[model samples]
Target chain A: MGVFGHKTVSMTAKIRLYVDHPLGDGQTVPLDRDQAHYLFGVMRQQEGADVALFNGRDGEWLAQVTQAGKRGGELTCVRQTRPLQMPPDLWLLFAPIKKARTDFIVEKAAEMGAAKIIPVQTEYTNSERIRQDRLQAHAVEAAEQCGGTYVPEVTDLQRLDRLLADWPSTRRLMFCDEAEAGAARALGAAPRGPWAILIGPEGGFSVTERAKLHGLPFAHVVSLGPRILRADTAAVAALTVWQQALGDWDGPQSD
Target chain B: MGVFGHKTVSMTAKIRLYVDHPLGDGQTVPLDRDQAHYLFGVMRQQEGADVALFNGRDGEWLAQVTQAGKRGGELTCVRQTRPLQMPPDLWLLFAPIKKARTDFIVEKAAEMGAAKIIPVQTEYTNSERIRQDRLQAHAVEAAEQCGGTYVPEVTDLQRLDRLLADWPSTRRLMFCDEAEAGAARALGAAPRGPWAILIGPEGGFSVTERAKLHGLPFAHVVSLGPRILRADTAAVAALTVWQQALGDWDGPQSD
Candidate 1:
C-alpha cells in the first residue's frame, strides 16, 4: 500500500480532515454536521471516497467514507498512512496585531512547523485580548491544508513580563530586536534545543522590556535585516530564519 | 545629523510617505487629494508638522507640511534623511493565487527586499488576471510601513514559459520544488548577484514545467522543508533563506 508515504497517500486521498477521535485500523470515525456538509455538499465526497484523517496524536490514517448524510457522516479507517511527524520543539511567541494579521501569523506558524504558538502582550502591544479558540481553529485549518500530521497549539494571550519571569532556562529565546536592526547576529551558530522566536509588536518593545530581555541569559538577540518589518511579517520571517537555522528545515528528516 | 540614519530619521518623523515628485533640499512636493485626506483628515497632521518622504529614485527626505487642505497639500523638503537603500537584485516569480494572498506575496516581497515582483501564469495557476496597479499600491504601502526607501515594481501577469524562455542567463532562479520536499539543498553556497525566487501556485506546476525548470542550468532547485507550504508562506520563507544566504541581510550595513 502507498499509504505509508505522505505524498503518495495524500495524492490518493485529496481531502485531509482533522478529528478529535483516535485513528486506527478499522476504526469508525464520526464526523460533525459541518464536516458532513463539507464532504457531502461542498466537496461532494461520497460514500467509498477516500479521505485522510489525523487527530494530532495518532498517525495519519486512510479512511473511506462509509455513510455520508446532510447532517452527519462516518468514515472507517483503512490503515495508518503516515506516522506522526512531530514538528521541531520550536515555539513562536509574538505580540498580536490586528485581527486578520494575527490570524495570518497563527496560520503561517502552523504551516511552518511551529510546535506551539503564544500571543504575548508587551507594553507596546495594541491588542489587549485575542480569541484563542479562533486562532487555534486557524492553526488547524493551516495544518489541514499543509499536509501536517501535527497541529500546533495556540495559547491565550499572556503578559510578556510574566512569561519571561518563569522562563525555562534550557529553552532558548530568539529575540528579534528592532533596535538592533541590520545587526549581523544570525541564528547560524545558536544552540537548538527547545527554542522559541519572540517577535515584538508594531510599536516594538518598550525600553524597559528591551532591557529586561537583553539581560536574560537565554535570550539571543538577532535581527531580520535592515528594514523595520511589521509585526506580522516579522513573525513569518523570524519563523523561517529559525526553522532554516535550527528547526526541522535541515534536520534528519530532510534529505 | 541623525537624519542620515534610517532609525534616527524614522523616530523623528513617524509618518513616511511615498511621493512621485523629486525630493531635494528646499524643494516642494505636492500631495494628491487622497494623500491630503490621509495626512489632514485621517492622521490630523497640520501645517508645520514634519513628515518623511521618499521617491523610488531619491533617498528619504525630511519635510514639513507647508500647506494643508482637504483637496491637496504641499510639503517643503527640509533635508535628505536616509540615503536611498536599494534592495538586493532579486525578482520574485510566483504564480498568483487568491486575490488577498497575491496581495500578501507582493507586500512581503517588498518588505523582504525584492527589487522586482512578477506574477507568472503557470499551467495550474487559478487566477487569470491580476490588477498590476493595485498590487503596486500594496508594494508601496508595504515599503512605507516597513520603512524601506525602495519600492519593488509589480509587473503585469505573464506566462511562465515565455518568461523562462527569455530568462536572463546571469540571473539565477531559485525554483522552490515541492516535488523535492525534504531535500536538504540549502542555498548557503549559491552564488549571489541577480537572483530570483520562483514559487509555484496552490495547485503547483505541471510535470512538464517542473521538468523544464530542473533541466535549466541556471535554476537552483531547492526544498523549503518536509511538509508543503502554501505559496505565500513559501514566498516569505524562500526570501528569508535567500536573503540570509546571499542577499543584503549580512552586508556592510550590518554590524
Candidate 2:
C-alpha cells in the first residue's frame, strides 16, 4: 500500500460496500444473503476480488473475497484505506414531501454531508409518515456511491411543533422561509458549531408556524432566492448553502 | 391592483399556466389540447376560473377562463400581476446523466435561476444525446411550479471540445473538478457578469479533458467538497454556490 494506502486500494477496487461490522486488519466479514446476491448475482464478483468496505466508524478497509457462494459470502480485510471523516455537526430538519422526492432529499443530504436527517411533519406537509428504513437505505447507497464513509441516520417522522418544543439551545436552525424571498439574510454571518436546516413543505409553513419559528432565538430565517423552490429543491439548496457557508467546504479534508 | 398586483392574482388563482402566446391587458390566449385537458379533465377547472399565465416574454397575467372544453380552451387576461423578472446572465453546462436525474437537473436549474441550460458531451460522458424538447418542457414545468416568471432554454447536446473551442471569452466558467476535492478554492471572489457552471458526468472528465479545462483562461476550477457528489447533486450545489457568491441571491427581486 502506498503512502496513505488510498491510491492502492482505489486502483484495485471498483466497488465500495457499506457494512455494519467493524473494519480492521485481518478481520473476516460475512456477507448476508442480499449482499451475496449483489456481489455474486448482480456484480459477478468471484473469490480473490478486492472490495472496499466501510462500517461508518472504523474508516474504510480493503478486503478480499475469500469465500464466494450463491447464498452467502465472506471477505477478509487486508488493510485500512482511509480513516473516518466525520461531517460537520449539521442536521437537516424538513417537512417530508412525496415518496420519490423525499428519497431524493435523503440521498442528497447524505452525499452533501448532513450528519443527521429528520423528517418533520408540518401543518402543510403532504406526507403523513415516511419509511425510515427505506430512507436510511437510500442514505447508505448514496454514501456508497459518493465515496462517503459516514452515513447520516434518517429518523422517523416527527411533528414539527414537537421537535421545536424541546429544541436544543446550542444548535442553530437555518430556516428557509418562502415568505422571506428577496430578503438578503444569509448564513454567512451565523456562527457554525452546530446547525440544522429547516425546509418546509410544498405549501410552505403555516402563518402560525412561521410566526413561532421567527420568534425562536435560534432560528435564522433566510430566503433561497426570488423564486419559491419546491420542498425537495429547497432541501438540496439549503444543504448546499449551509455547507458552503458554515460546513467543511472551506477547509481541507480532515481525514 | 395593490402595488405589484401579485397578492390579488395569487390569492384568486390557484393554478399557474405557461402559455406560448403573449400576455397583456385584455389579451385572449388559446390553450392547446394537452393544456386544455390538464385544466379541464385533470384539474377540473371550469369556465370563469382564474388562472395565472406567463409567456416567457410579457410579465405574468391574471386570466379568466372564457371557454373550457375537453380539447381546447381560451382565457382573457385581466391585468398584469408581475413584471418579467429575468435571471442573471448565467448558463449551466453539464453532461447528461440518467433520464430522471437529467430532468431533475433541468428543473432545479430553472428554479435556481440559470438563464440557459446546455448539455455537453465529455470524454467519459455516458449519454450521446438528450431530448431537448422534453427537457425544455421540464424547465417550463419547473418555472410554473416554482413561481418563476422566466424559463431557461434547454439546448441540445453539444460536444464539450467544440463548445470550449468557440467558448465566449466574456463568460466565465466555474469548472467543478472531482480531482480537486478538498481544495479550498471557491467562487466567492469571482465577478458577477456573464458566467457558466460546468458539471462533469458520473465517470468525470478524462485526464486530457481536465487538462484542457484547466488550461482555459476563463475556467476557474473549484471543488464542491470532500465527498464526491453525483452529477445531479453537483449541478444543484454548483448552482447554489454560484448564486450565493455572484448571482442574484444577494439582491432584491429585480423585475
Candidate 3:
C-alpha cells in the first residue's frame, strides 16, 4: 500500500472478499462458503453490490456481487483500482512460540512487510505444531488493518534442520544468533542480498543447532546485540535490524 | 559492554546479583528482605558463598556472604572482578501500556542496554497508575537474566506532555512517529548523539501530541517503516533500529 491513503466510494461495502480465482475484469469469482457467510450473512452485502478484491498478484479491484445465496456468494471482478503493494524482500523465520506469542509474531511480521513467514522447529523448541491457517488469517487481517495490498504467505511448519538440508541456493540467511558473547558487529554494513532472519525459541537454539547454523556457507551470523532476548523480541529485533540494514526500509522502495 | 569477549578472564563461576546498597570494597552490604529471600531462599546461597555484585557503577566484584537469613542477609565486598559495564548513553521514553506490557517494556529496556527507562502518560493512554517498585524489580530480574552488569533506573511515571516540555537541550529525540508513513528515512543516517527512542501507547499518540512532537526542533521524526506496529513491537523495533543505527551494538567499548 502506498503511504498515502486513496479514497474509494465504496458503499454497501462489497466487504473486500478473497476468492481462489484468477482475478480479471468480467471474470466471475466464486466465493468459498466461509467468505460467502462473511459477506452475505455477516456483512449483509446484497446482490449487485460492489466490493473490493485482491490476490497477491492482482492489484486491488472493485467487484460487483453477482449472486448472494444462503450458503454461498459470487461476484464478477470489475476493475483493478490499486496496484498490489509488493511486500519487502524479507523473510521471517522463527521457532514457533506459545499460541499468543506465535500469533503475535505473525501479526507483527506481516505488519512489518515480511514477504514470507516461516515457522521452524528447533532442537530446544517446545512447540512443533502450528496452526498454519490461523496464522495465515492473522497475516491477512494484519495486511487489511495496515491498509496493505500485499499479504505474506505463511508456510506450513517445518523443522529447522530440514529447511537447512538443501537450502535455497540464492537466498541468504541472516541468523539472529543471540549468544554472540559480545561481538558487537555493526548492522550498518550488512551485505545486500536476498535475506531471511531466523529467530530462535525462548530457550534459544541449542548448541548443536547453533553450530550447524554457524557452519552454513550462506548463513550470516549477526547479533541483535548482547541481550538474551526472548524469542519473540529477537524476531522483532532481528527484523528491524535487517530492515534498517538490507531490507526495503530505507530509501525509496521500487514497486 | 566491550565490543568483543576478547579481554580474557581467568574463568570463575559468576552469578550476577542485585543489591540495593551502593557497592564499595570493605563495605559490608546488607541485603534487604527481598534480596535476602532471593539469594538465600531461591538461589540457595549459603553463608561464605561467593557471588558477584554490581550497582550500575563500580565494576562487578566478588562478594562473600557474611550472614545468611531468610528475611535478611549480609555480604562483604571482596576484590573487584570485572570492570563496570557502562551501558551506552540511551534513554527509553515510552508511553505506559497495561500492567504486564508496561513491565515488559521496562524489563526489555534494561536488558537491551538502556541507561534509564522513563514511563510517560499519553493522551490516549488509559492507565495513569504505576507500581514503580514492581517495575523496578522486573528491570532487575531482566538484567540478571541477560547477564547485564548495569540495571537501568526506572523512574516514576510522568505525564508525556510534561516530560516533553523540558526536552533536554543536548539529547536528541528519535520520535518513532508512525505519521512518517512510508517515507524510508534510514535512521542509520540520522545524527547520533545522546539519544532517546520514544514509543507511543496502544491507541497511539494523539494528533495534538504528534503535532507538539513534530514541532520540536531537536526531534528527528522517523518511521519504524510500513505497517502499523503494536505498541510493544514498536518499542522493540525502535530500540533495535537505534542500536543498529547509533547505539553501542556495534561500537567499541574500552575498559
TM-score attained by model 2: 0.94
lDDT against the true structure, per candidate, is 0.84, 0.83, 0.74
lDDT of 3 by residue, A54-75 (tens): 7767777779889998778789
Q: What is the TM-score of chain A alone in each candidate?
A: 0.92, 0.93, 0.84
Docking class of 2: acceptable
True contacts kept of each: 0.32, 0.35, 0.26
Ranking of models by TM-score: 2, 1, 3
lDDT of 3 by residue, B1-255 (tens): 211111112324346687667777787898889889888898888998887787767766778999999889799988887677767788998877767678777876876788899988888676888888898889988776565678898999889888888778988888886657544345657676688878877666666888898898878877776555666777788887777667777644331
Q: Per model, state how many residue pairs clash.
A: 1, 0, 2
Leading candidate by DockQ: 1
What is the alpha-carbon RMSD of candidate 3 to the true structure?
Answer: 5.6
* Candidate 3 residue spans exceeding 4 A from truth: A1-83, A97-103, A126-145, A178-193, A201-208, A251-255, B1-16, B24-28, B39-52, B59-68, B75-81, B179-190, B252-255
CAPRI verdict (incorrect, acceptable, medium, high) for model 1: acceptable
TM-score of chain B of each: 0.93, 0.93, 0.87
Per-prediction DockQ, in order?
0.40, 0.39, 0.22
Highest-scoring model, lDDT = 1
